[model samples]
Target: MEQPKRLSRLKTTALPTSLSDHAAAFDRLHPQVQRWVRAQGWSQLREVQTRAITAIGGHRRDVLIAATTAAGKTEAAFLPLLGAAAARQDRGVAILYVAPLKALINDQHKRLEGLCADLEIGLTRWHGDAPQGPKTRLLKSPEGVVLITPESIEAMFVRRPASVEALFGRLDAIVIDELHAFLQGPRGLHLWSLLHRIDAISHSRARRIGLSATLGDKQHAAEWLAGEGPQPEIIAVDGGGAPLKLQVRAVVEPPETSPPTADLEARSALAEIARHAHEILRGKNNLFFAGSRANVEALADRLRTLSEDGGVPNEFFPHHGSLAKELREEVEARLKEDRLPTTAVATTTLELGIDIGSVHSVAQLGAPRSLASLRQRLGRSGRREGSAAIFRGYIREPYLAADADPLDRLHLPVAQSVAALHLLAERFVEPPSGDPALLSVTVHQLLSRIAERGAQRADQLYRAIGRDGPFAAIEPGDFADLLRGLGGGEEPMLEQAPDGSLMLGPLGERLTASRDFYANFKTDEEWRLVNQGRALGTLPIVNALAVGSILSFAGRRWRAVAIDDPAKVVEVVAHRAGRIPKFDRVSGEPIHDRLAGAIRDALVASDMPAYLDPVAAQLLAEGRDMFAALDLARTPLIAAGKDTHLMTWRGSVANGLFAVLLGSVGFECETFDVGVTLLGTPSDEAAHVLGALDGCPPIETLGRFVSNLAHEKYDDYIPEDLLRRFWVKRHAHLETDVADMIRRIALALS
Candidate 1:
């Protein structure tokens, strides 16, 4: 069925005359929805709600709801969706709700269960942890909204292509939550390819609807969501909420009066924090976001110890991806109950919306990875009415020796956190970048599509996976080269039989058999952690464990009874006071250039940020003094003893290119925090190298030194030439002028 004739009017049209018109739009929704709204005791619709009703209900256009968290973003997208479903034929699934995280989908399914039950709309969630019963039931009778993750969608395409087609034959809409999470990188590209694949298979023009709280660039987000279709009518809503309460404080390892040993001082610092946490956060619902899972474990354990010492209940819990689903769910259940005072020390696992009730405060152990993340973490708190969002940033930088690098010793962590808060205070968020040649995800899709449909012609494949695909930026020549490389190599992934049909070769079949092929996201080698033959969770192989090893996981200690190789399982039993095993949490998104520049600005600026505590203020002053001594603004290049550092206030991609360029010219370089460091070359030698490149060399020429080109799944199958081309296009900021960089280095040497 075609959208309403006046769908375009919703874009270039005037507003409704009065409040009655808006109310009439709401009244148009099914009576069940109206009753549900009344049962909730909501007086009126929010801005996004009204806008969604007007655009989706009246105009019938694809919609992108961009609003703040707790602004009823999910409701804004789903209200129209379910209302439309109410009038449609319930044959196969009517709506497909895709979330980035399984936890998010599970949370939404539970939250919407009441409404879905009230409307009698069948709702089923399918993810890794979800029981097979719902999936099997949905397969038998696919109807209503099906909540899933992107990986699960890929799995459905692979495992039940025919079922997927039948199920989504008359799909009404595709609702994407956390849309910003899928705007860039392999996951985003994978989602785009999956959507296009679904469209091709089902032959249904399901209207796409995206819901997100943080979209850096609205135009880019709209284009990303729309793809080849008409641009989604963007509904940007400003939620009026209470002001934010932000505080940044610094913790020195030891007191200034009596200096202690590093280990002792570290212990004291942890103790001091636990005491402070007890005073400020005890007996209150809150969350603490640590820099890493290890930190979360260490801190939560310390907090538990403190509670035990004080004869109080241990309300602290550690939450991360490695924990068992049962434990994580238990944490969620406790938080939702909101009876006992609880605090979850976590990584980004809990940052997204999970409806775990209102948190009184959200604390950070260090500076957040990005401004967008900071915004999301802040949104987790202050969700209740009349309550201001409270954020406390604890920046702990152990004291370095007096002769240590001034830049490192001045405790810049707190300053950077304060600077980020300043940006947050101004409501400055890093816009999601939509443009990137995702050859990695393209490779995954190429394999997946071919697997779905036995053989695909080169032309049709190109059109469906390239030109008309998410990787539109990828050139035809590069795509052809990639195919030839994958099919022509000694270990070929594809073989062209007689009839010119390409099919998976022996190597391809082996790859497809692996369980990890479903996901486009990069993950480390992990072992399943089992207890008495029951699965507890998984631990990264990098954690270094052997049979009989005892470690802490899931907020409990366990002894590794056995390590089964073929089964890839580590059997463990309960133990006490086990050593905290080394575990790694994948790094967050790369730092944006704006936030990096803000940190640099904070170092040079004279004004003291009001959010900083006395220790942080003192550190900021010292950092300013050190920066002045080095005169880094005019000359970002500096000599720190034997090493020469080129401080490029640019992002990781740009800094990476700069390092590769220097290495290409025989100056071995490596990327450090906010700059590139010449590994063995002298400062003067670095200057000479930079001065020689007055007419900067083409970035592509430096690809020879660019190791690790095969960072993605099938990147190894990509031809070297095309891989380098794609890398330079995606990573190297060649669009930026290099003349300024060259001049700065030369002047520093002089």
Candidate 2:
């Protein structure tokens, strides 16, 4: 086998020569902070810290610090802000730290405790699990820093609206950790609205500071952080030239003969992955990303059993959203202490920066959801000096039999993995792509704003939540329509008074009164899993299980002895044999067009990636051979028996639009990763249809073919036409992306 090509090393930026410059930055810090730095035995400040001090302390500008993980970004943002806060005599909260997750807030609370204590700044943790004494004290005398999550902020707006002004009216800075996580989702939009709302409430101009390790579009992120404010000073630093060491391993399972055989094949493949992971990573501290909750539980259980069989202490644990807080925290604590070698099989929960002590490497069980995710996961390793960042990827591909589906024979997963590795080497990261008109979150913020101010005019609500807010995609007409629907629907959520102010209606009062209304995202109903009256975890109610059913959870097997339907609790006991339970979550993300193109390129190229093991190389060769044999390079449409496959080579969104277009035109179709399948349609007929296509069909015509339109939390409450508009705006880029795809397919078919 040929040796893999190594990624080019990044050039390190030259540091300033003048010692006086460094001293100037150090002198800008508060005296106590300077002493604290000296006590830690630090020689000089890092480049990011110095730059941040100059930008934040000297100019008092909003800043976005983009650097590698564990590169002192927290200190860079806090030191200057803390110094400024100490210089002020105002009593309100000085800094408002907003994070995406409660765990991250908890981690920062522990990490910043010493610094705040030394500076005599009051630090408070405000979240669901945080103690009430500190919260009450802070409410009485709001001061110093308050670390909180988005949900907590929403809760305050709804439940303690009158007190919000007192708590954050004089805030000096708003520090957002993991800024990229909030860039392009419903949660991001919700946070954006909250930030604007905070600004509206505060008397002081709070400088916004965003911190992230993975930002593909810095300009877009900067604009997001600034909102209507001035553009933030971007402080980006490349990783200190750490070489990446990567390898891709392939696991092949027997062709599926039936449902039972397919299940056995999956188990066999998982076992193989576990054997390899145990042999290689057992004695080292590392993170194994299993991509989903079910996979996390299965892999962790297998690793635990492997340890027991080897007569060694268990070092593997599971961490995900569904696990009980105590169980998850125990795993986190074990990893941080590093008293013993620990390997955590987790989902995206552990991908964020939680100050888990440095690990040896990262293992991914499949192709990562996106290149950005892969980059973030890899950042968890190679923190120690002179150590290369290590990544191990395991891709399970089905054995190609003569009767295999064309999609299976292409080995798309293996191809996708290789493409991601190549893109990483090329320093390519996907930009944030989310719905522009996130009407669901708009509804959430609309109600939140009304509840916050007691009552609001229609124009005031539109301006606050739409025109000058994150939901800028909404037009004035659509805003009016939304307001009308909310104020006059069968189940009105808003009522208009004689003064023309919109207030909470009966249904709205009921919703806003509940604690569950704080969240912008939708959550499935779940049943708690209890063992001997102790909470183990939660399983989605969608997972059907009877009393005799045995399942794996929290890295252990359990038998459901009884399920209390009224209480929504499952009583379980230890069991030796069990199967993994399915959760109501999609395991994959929308593949970017660039990634899809890269996969197509990988299949067509002759040169193989050096990082692939022998088995992986063989799989690539097989895919390439199949690609050539089917003449997929020359045409986008191919006939495989009675069906025709149109290889659009576009992202999932575009392909979904293409499928809908076909279905609207009276052709039965389905979508895969790269293409749409026209069932029972011959190649010639498919080509004729494709060549005759002009542009995207009407939204109403396409809507007839789409399902699951009510995906967002508040989508059901929205008017039907507006809901369809939201779906079309988010899922289908009809006028531009889909139209362009149609033209491309037409030309190819012609």
Best candidate according to lDDT: 2
Q: Which ranges in model 2 have alpha carbons more than 4 Å from their true place?
A: 1-20, 255-267, 434-437, 524-588, 698-701, 730-734
| Span of ten consecutive residues with least summed lDDT in model 1 | 579-588
- Residue 559 error, candidate 2, Å: 35
Model 1 CA lDDT for position 211: 92
- lDDT per residue (tens digit) for residues 250-282 in model 1: 776653444546667446656667667767898
Candidate 2, residues 166-265, lDDT tens digits: the string is 9999999999999999998778988998899899888967999999999888778888998988667788877464678988999986545665664674
Which pairs clash in model 2?
Answer: 4-610
Candidate 1, residue 325: Cα displacement in angstroms equals: 1.0
Q: What TM-score does candidate 2 get on C-alpha atoms? A: 0.88
**Each prediction's TM-score versus the true structure:** 0.86, 0.88
What's every prediction's RMSD, in angstroms? 8.4, 9.0
